[model samples]
Target chain A: MRLILRQRELVADAWRYAGEEAGADAPLIATLAELRTDPERHLARRGALGVRLTPVDRVEELATHLPRLALVACEFPGPGEGRGYSQGRLLRERYGFAGELRAVGAGVKQDLVFHLARCGFDALELAPGEDPAAAVRAWQRYEVGYQPGAAQVVLRRQRFFAATPPA
Target chain B: MYQYDELDQALVDARVAEFRDQTRRHLAGELSEEEFRPLRLRNGLYIQRHAPMLRIAIPYGLLSARQLHTLAAVARRYDRGYGHFTTRQNLQLNWPRLEDVPEILAQLATVQMHSIQTSGNCIRNVTADHLAGVAADEVDDPRPYCEIIRQWSSVHPEFTYLPRKFKIAVTGSPADRAASEVHDVGLHLVRDAQGQLGFTVLVGGGLGRMPIIGQVIREFLPVADLLSYLEAILRIYNRQGRRDNIHRARIKVLVKALGIERFRDLVEAEWQENRPHHVQLPQAEVERVRAFFRPQPYEILADLPAPAGNARLQAWYRYNTHAHKVPGYRAVFVSLKAHGEVPGDMSAEQMDALAEIARRYSFGLVRVTHTQNLLLADVRQRDLEALWRELEALRLATPNIGTLTDMIACPGLDFCSLANAGTLDVARQIQQRFDDLDYLYDLGEIEIKMSGCMNACGHHHVGHIGILGVDKHGEEWYQITLGGSASGVTALGEVIGPSVRKNEVAATIERIVEVYRGVRADGERFLDTVRRLGIKPFKEQAYAPHPAAA
Candidate 1:
C-alpha cells in the first residue's frame, strides 16, 4: 500500500543517488529543479523517477522542456497560490505536452482537482494513505462556466450588430 | 428616461453576469481579497463601517415611476427598508450583505438599472438640471446628452481607472440648477452667436479638499464633438493627473497645479491627436434618444387659480413650486428634506403613491433634484389641488422648500463612514426651530447646507448659509459661511467667523437671519442682501458676545 509519489520518490532517489543503504526497491522521484532546470540530466539517467516543480516556476518554460523529458512533475507550494494552475494551462494548450503534471505537496486539496484538471493536471499526489478516487470526484461538481476553459462545452458568443460594416 | 436598446441591454446583462462570476470566485476563495476588492468596487459594492452599501445609478436624476418602484423593491428586499439619494443624483442602499450583492444587481438589471461606475475612479453618474425639459428658461432638454455621456463613460476601457473619481454636470437653463461650476467637467448647453446649440465646456471645478470654480477651456465645443472632446480631457487626466498623492489626484488639483492655460493647452493637444478616431454622434441616434423624452402634452389654461383658504396648500405652492414653460402647467417640487427626516428618503409605500400621482397628473415622470427634492413636472393648474391633497396625505407636501428647514444635508455621522459630525440631527433641530412656513416664506430663499466634514459631500460651500462640521477637541463644532450660491453666476460661500459649537448653530443661523432682516432695504433676497452688505455686517452680529444683562 506504500505507493511512492513524486516528492517522496525524489527524496528516496536522492538518498540512493548519495549511495544510502536503506530500501533498494523504493521508487525514485525527480525534484522540481529536474523539471524546471536541466531536464535532460534527470531524463537521460534515472530509475523509477518523477519530477517536482513549484507553481512559481514558470509553466511556459515547461511547454518545450516537458516533451524531451520522459517524466515530469509539478508542485503547488502552498494553499491559494495559483501560478501552478496557469503553468499547467500553458503545458496543455500551447506545447500540447500530454505527460503527467502531478499536483504535489501541502497544496494538494481534494477541492482543487477539477481546476488542476482544467489546467491539464491528469495525475495527483496526495498525502500518505489518502484515496485518489474521492479526489477525482471533486472535479465533477460544477457543470457550467460563463467563460471558456479546458472543460467541455466551451461557449463562444458572436455578436452581429446591423450597423457595423463588414471588415 | 432613455429606453435601453438591445445593444445596451445586452451590454448590461453581460456586465451583470461578469460581475456575478467575479463575486462567486471571490466568495469561493478562487480569487484573493486584493483581486476581488477592485472588481466589487467597480460594480458599486462598498464594504462600509456597518454593512455592505450598494449605490444605484440614477443618471442625471431622471427616473420613471417603474424605475423608482424597482428601487423601492430593492430597498425593501435587500436593504434596511430605505435608501439614501446622493448629491450626484444616485441612490445608495445601506445594509446589503456581501453575499446578496449579485442578487441585488440582478434585480436592478431587470429594471434597466445597474450600479456600474458609481463608486470607482471613473466617470460617475452625470447630473443635470432636475427641471431640464419643463423649465421655462431651458434651451433644450439636457437629458439626451446626459444619457449619451452616461453610456460613453460607463466602464470605459481607457478612463475607468483614473487617478481619482470624475463628475460632470450639465445645465440647459441659464439659471444653473445643476451646479455645473462645482463638477469636475461642467457642460453648459448654450447657443453660439450663429444660434447653434453647443456646450461651453468648463474643466477642473470641484468641491473636495481644495474647492474651485471650473475654468472655461473651450468657449463653444460643437455639439457633435461632445464625446470626442470629453475623451480628450479624460485622456489628458489619465496620463498626467497626479497618482502619487491621493489628495492631489483630482483633476481640479492638477488643473490648479498646471494652471488653467497649461491644462487647456494639454487638453487641446490631446483633442487634436485623438479627434479623428472618436465615434461620431449620428443625428438619428440623437433623435432616437430625444424621442424617449418628448414634451408631455400640457393643457392650455389662462391663469393659476387665486390662493384659496387652504393656507397650508398655498404655503406649500408658494415655497415649493416653480414656474413651468408651458402656460398652464406647473413644476411641483416634493420636499424630501423635511425636518427630522433623512434627506432623499422614500418608503416603498410612499414611492408607490408618488408613482400613482405621476401617472395620474404629470405624464408618468418623476425627477430627483440636486437639492434632495423631487419634482412632478407638467402638472395642470386644475389638478394642483388634488395633487396637493394626495401629497399632503403622504407627508411629502412640506411647505418649507428652499427655506431654512428644507436643509440640503449629507448622511453625516449616521451613515457616511467618512463624516466627522452629525448633520441629520442638526438639520432636524433647525427644522424644528424654524417650523413656521409663513415666517420662512417671508425670510425668502435661504439655502442652509450642512456637511459633516471638509470633503464637502453636502456642498456646504454653495449654500446661502453653509454649516461645516469639524471635530474640535473630541466634540462637534460647526463653522458658518454666508453668500455661497450654485445658481446663475456661481460663487463659493464665505465663512463669517470662527467655528461655533454644534448646540449653538440654531441660534447662530437665527442671528444671521435677523441681521439680514434688519439691514434689508426693500425687496432683497437673503443672498442679494449678503452680496450687497458684504460679510462684515453678518460677521459682527454672529460673533458679537452676548451683552452682560444688569
Candidate 2:
C-alpha cells in the first residue's frame, strides 16, 4: 500500500486521487469536466464528493459546488506549470472551501512541497519515484515567506520592520 | 543598503541550511540529477560547460566595503582567483565546485548577501540605477522601493516556477540611467502634481531571442499600490504564458499576443481581485526601509578650490565623473574596460584594493552599474585629483568612459555553454582597432554592445552599434545592428544587411563609424546620427566592396 503526506507527516490520504488505490467506500474523485456536465450525479452517490481541478480549469467552476465538495484536489499539468498553486489558493481563500484541499499530479516534485503546503494544500500525493519521507522532511524548508498564504504567516507584516497592525 | 534584521537574517540562514542538505542528498544519490536541477538553480548554482557557476545578488547595485572584502575572500578560497561582474549588476563565480556551493552560500550570509533567485524561472535580482541616491536629478531615491520589491519577491512560493525568468528595473531620475524601459517591469518613481509619490509602470520589455520595449500599463500607480499591482501582473503571466515552447515563454510574447489594451484589462481585473487585503505597503514599513537609505552625514562644504592636477588628471575627471546631488561631492566611475583586459572581470587583489579605496574616499560605499563598471557614490570634489593619482597607480584610471572603446559584451563562447560564437575576441579585436585614445575620444559617446547569440545577455539590441556573433556552418559570422537606445525611448536596433565573416567585423564597424563621422551633423551622437540619416547610408557603406575587408 502507498502512503501520502499531510502537513509534513507520512499518512494515508482519506480522499482517493484520480488513479490511486481506494476502497469501495472511497469518495469518487470527479474531474472538472464531469462536474460541469453532471453535477447532480456526482453529488448523489459517494462517501464524499472529491472534485479535481486541472491546471487550466477556472477556479470559479468549483465555486457552486463548494458546499458539497468534501475534498478539492488540484493537479499540476507540467513541471513549470504554476496555475495549480493559484488554483489551490482560490479554492481555499476566495470560495472559502474548508474541506480537505489535496494537491496531486506527477509533476509535483519534493522541492515544490513547501510551496504546495503554503498555497493551502493540507495533503499532497507525491510524484512517482519521489520519497514520501523526503516530502515530509522537505515541507519544513522555509520558516518565513514574503506573501501571505493560506497556512503561512506574511513576513512583510511580521514584527521585524515595524510594529504589527492592530488586531 | 537596507540592513537586515533578525527575521531576515534567519530566513537567509534557513535557506542556506536547506540548500546544503539538498546538495548532500544530491551527492549521496538520494536525489536524482533531474530532481536537483531546479533546486540548485534556485540557489544560483549552474552546471556550466566546464564547472559549476554561482551567481550572487548585488541588490540595487549597492555594496559595502566589508562586503567587497568578503567577496574577495570568497574568490580566493574558491575556484579561481577572480569573479565576473555581469550586466545585470550581479557577481558570478564562473568556476565553483558544486560540492562547495553550500559552504560558499554560508560565507555569503555573513555579509548579508545570497544567491537566491539569481537563476531558474524565478524573479531575478532587482536592479536600479547605480547612482540612485546620488544622481543630480531631483527625485525620490528608487532603492527603497527596490528593497521592498526584493523582500516581497524573495522565495515567493507562487512565483518560484514560471514560464521563464522575470526581471524588474527601477529608476528614480528622468534621465533613465538604469535602462528601466527594457526590463520585464520598468518602474519609474515619479511624483504627482499633488506632490504624492507614485510610479509609472511598464510591462513586457525584455531582451533575448526577441527584444521589445515595454508598454505603459499604468501611468501613475500610488506607491502603496505597487506590490498588489505587481502580484496581479505576475499572476496573470503565470497562468497565461506559453508553456509548450521555451522560445515564446517570456512575458513579452504574451503581452504582444494579447495586445497591450487587453493585457492591461486582465491585469487590472486581477489587481482588483487581489487589492485591499494583499501585500500593500504600509506607511511604517515604507519609512522603515527608507530610513536606511537616508542621506549620509555629509559635511557642508559650500565650494572647493580649483584642483591642482596635470592634463591627464583633468581628462580622467571629465569622463569618469558624474554630477552628484550634493554640491561638493561627485560620483566617480571606475572603468573595468582597461586596454587588453576583460570588460567586467576584476581580480581578487583589485577587489581588495577597491574596498580600501571606497573606505578612504567614498563613505565606505560602492555601487556596481548595469554597464559592469564600479561607482564610488560619495567622492568629494577636493579629493578628485588625489583619488585619480591613486587609481592611476592601480591601472583603473582609464579615461575612456562613454567613448567608442568602452563597450559591453557578454561571456560568449569562452565561458558560456549557450554561446554559438565568441564575443570576447570580437570585443578585443574592436578595442584593438580603436586603441588610439585620441581617435577614440573623437568618436565620442558611442555605445557598442555585443552578444554571442540571440539570447542577448550583452544587451546588444539596445546598443548604438550592436554586433551579434552567429554560427555560419561551424565557423563564426557576425551581424551588425544600428540605431538602438535603451533610455527614455527604448528601441531594438535594425540589422544593416548580410552577415560578415568574423575577420571582417572590425573593418565593418570601422567603415560604419567612418560614415557616421562623414555625414554626422556637428556634435551629434552616434545614435542620433544613425537615427537622423537612417540605416540606408550605413548599409551602403558597410556592404560596398571594401578593400580593407579583402
Separately for all candidates shown, the number of backbone clashes (residues 3 or more apart, or on different chains) is 4, 0
Off by over 4 Å in 2: A17-25, A152-167, B305-309, B544-550
Query: lDDT by residue for model 1 over B78-119, one digit each (tens)?
Result: 877778877878888888988888888888888898998888
Query: What is the alpha-carbon interface RMSD for each candidate?
Result: 12.0, 4.4
Q: How accurate is candidate 2 locally (lDDT)?
A: 0.84
Task: Quote the positional error of residue B418 for candidate 1 in Å.
Answer: 0.9
Displacement of the residue B265 alpha carbon in candidate 2, Å = 0.8
Alpha-carbon lDDT, every model: 0.75, 0.84
Query: What is residue B122's positional error in candidate 2, in angstroms?
Result: 0.8
Per-chain TM-score of candidate 1, chain B: 0.97
User: How much is the lDDT of residue B176 in candidate 2?
Assistant: 83
Q: Chain A structural similarity (TM-score) per candidate?
A: 0.63, 0.83
- Residue B438, candidate 2: C-alpha displacement in angstroms: 1.3
